[model samples]
Target: MKGVSTIQSFRVYKHGLKRLIQALGTEYVNLQNVYERLLVGIAPSHRIEAMIDDPFGELWREAQLLGRLRLRLWRSFKNFEDTVHDMREAVQEMMEKLGIGPDGEVEWIEHTSIRRQYKRVSFILQRSNYHDLLTRIREGVSSLQNMAIMNVNMESDRILRSQVRLNQLVNVTSNNIYHALRSTMTCRCQRLHEVGLRLTPPSRTIVPQDSDDDVIKELQFRLIISHMGPLATPSVRQWSEVLLQSARSQVREEPTTPLATKSSSSKKSVKFSVRSSVSSTNEFMQASAIIQPATATFSLGSAAMPVDSGMPQQIRDLCETMQTTEKRRSGDNCGHIQDHMSAKPSEYGVYFMDCLGDCENYVLVPLKDVLRDQSNGTLPPMLYSDKLRLAWVIACSVLQMQETPWIPSCPTHDDFYVVQKGGVPQYQNGFVLKHLPDRGGPGSTSTSTTSSARPTLLSLGIILIELILGQPLESLQPQDTPASQLSPSYEAANKFLGRVNMLGDLGISAPCNVVSVRYLKARTRRVS
Candidate 1:
């Protein structure tokens, strides 16, 4: 119907459009597959899942539109030349959606799913070869017009292999049972009715299924009670008989669980430790499957520590009490399963303070500014007793069950502004307290253990060390040229310790044999 040249040009353009659609469709399918793998495979709490959600969602929309455009391309054949023009415009639009710059580069800040996925994969795999993987994918897209069918198939196979390897890496990187259990040791442990406060909605008969979410929750409650001790409940004497019967059941089920009735059983029990040996190499360990009642140990101290070791009274009393109480414990549906106490800090228990709360509102100032007028001369050295006093407070708060006495957390010079009111330091004297976090007092939990205090102790320790050293822990980063060789906080304390011969091999010091840095070092080591 037309000249030979015109017919040939239309054919060339139509084939080009076919190649473009095929190439894009392959990419779209692969991207979708990888995203679906991540969405359902990972744990809900993992940060990587949250980071990928938006980018992957955007990619879904783009792919859907591209598919619609590809379908519309066929109807345009009615206008011959117009069909080729429409196809070119659609191709350009898809390319623009990819956010390629005029220079043919993707910006890192654009939050493109491809780039972020590459980053997430690289991070999880502990490798950085994703850049190459991304480049190859881009090159495959660019070569659509000329690339052989064999080449396209080969590229797709390689990308798929990378995706499978990434999934394998994720599985390989999950936490072991011991580590995983320890991480969630202080997490909220509630009963089926306790959390949702209902038995009728997710309706239950008098009989519940043997395998259910409730069963897992029951296992969790027993586990917490095994360590934290039972809260006060009415009819203690009646509860004693129930607990006694439960203990017999546990002993019968897990043959390794010793009978506490026998006085000779102490040596037979597996010793507890701060870092317990993991049960086995299973990918995901259930608390009910691996958690043994006798092995229940709290953090903050050594394992195999004796009862008379002078630990905090509450923790010591708690551990000793639980040792006896749990030995008489029952099965999945036994002792002390009521919501007598709530674990939600904000609701019933105290909500502990956050250190870097609303980081945007904080203002950084040098330490010297606040203490300019505190001393007669160049600020007198802070008393050794003061350091000891502060360190002990944090140590006890962290290690103890209940706070013995409320420890006053003080502000360091560089950290906050000071307003003195008639020789007292507080806002009452006119010191402006800005951007301070509300450290709500801890309320009750399923177990009102010292778990809340643990985080406080760790963070407070860092603050105290910085105050004593008169420098930030992260200040030595500049000197460590091979940065990765040294830890984030270079041991600045060791340098001073070495000078004073604290670590044994005496190097340099006043040799005065007078001033006692011994007390300070002892306190620091104990706190650390």
Candidate 2:
């Protein structure tokens, strides 16, 4: 009004002040109307003029702040969305390559035993692939964790930058608008007083103000929906790393002492004992070395050492009896103990298979050493049949005999098949399991009954079948047959001997080589 001419004021007074409003101070409008409209925030949407000629408009500053706020929010949301998408893709690829289920099941091997045997090179290639994929998976876990932290930091930086911008814009705009409003309003108030008129300010009704709180709540809601908790690495990978690291810790030196060293006279002979149990459910396949002079030998552990493993206790006892520092160290030895002997029960853990933690295989003693012992001169021609017969003898001696033919608690097989490191075989991941006593009935205990050597007869028959057919009784069963029909060792023994009995009566000669026939005849004469 001070800048406006008297004609303009008369025109404004006659018409209305709405058309003359511009920034904080207007050329043709009074500052009182502009201040009241901006502060109370009930202004009309229509602009007074086509352009904001002055830069000190409070309404314009509010709109600019809001627009920039919206753009910052949009950018933050987009960045979060992209991070989520990339993380999802990375996790998906990790799951596929690692062959792990969401529920933490590991694919033990993609190839079956037969497939690995037949396609050796292909299996090797797959193993290499698996190794690399495993390495990537481990690396990815660490990388993903770092990325989560990085994203959180970046998002925090973005919000802080936007906050700085908002503060800067708000500060400049507020100062300019405040000074302009004061200058213009003071002049108008003085003119109105000179005209003998009093300017009465309207009483603004104080309503409950919650706009700032509401804006903060909306931001919090957005943050909650876009949180990065879901981006954590899968638990399977975490548990698997635990297993891998645990296996690495189990690596130890193999015992290189021989089984038959004479001990010093000062040590007392400690008689070691065994716990025996037979299993009908498990089918054990001997290594090919079982039949050769390079027989299955033992080393203390393969990968894991039991905290209270009976193996160590028995080894101590063995050392006492032998009176030597090294007790029954495995390379090759006499065929004294055939079956594996453990104070507690044991199963053979697969080489790499168990390192992942499935851990459900049987263990064996160093009968290969005994076979090597037999391979020496002056021992009988324990060829294919003799080797098996000796195994049968050793199995019987370990089970029913209660004799300490083999003094060691754990048994082992030569891991010549495994890749050697620094010229020594890995043996800490090792143990020995003895042959189970042939059970008497469907629910019979592993302990042999006092009844006549009927178990021995049936076992001999099964052994005969094994030597003649060169296959397991279970393997000989008709394909597609239920295991229940041929269940338990007793049932197999009955079936095996029955067929052999018929073959003998029919003068079929029971299919034998000269050495086997001679050995059988001599043994039969001795028994009869």
Candidate 2 lDDT over residue span 155-272, tens digit each: 4565555444433332232222222212222221111210000111111111112132222211100000000111232121100000001111222455233211222333221111
Q: After superposing candidate 2 on the true structure, give the runs of residues whose Cα lies further than 4 Å from its correct spot.
A: 1-388, 391-460, 488-528
- For model 1, the superposed segments whose C-alpha errors exceed 4 Å read 1-19, 22-334, 337-528
lDDT of each: 0.27, 0.27
Model 1, span 4-74: residue lDDT tens: 55446444533443343344446434433333333332223463344233322223223222222222222
Deviation in angstroms for 253 in model 2? 41
Clashes of each: 10, 23
Q: All candidates' TM-scores? A: 0.18, 0.18
lDDT of 2 at 211: 32
Minimal lDDT window, size 10, model 1:
192-201
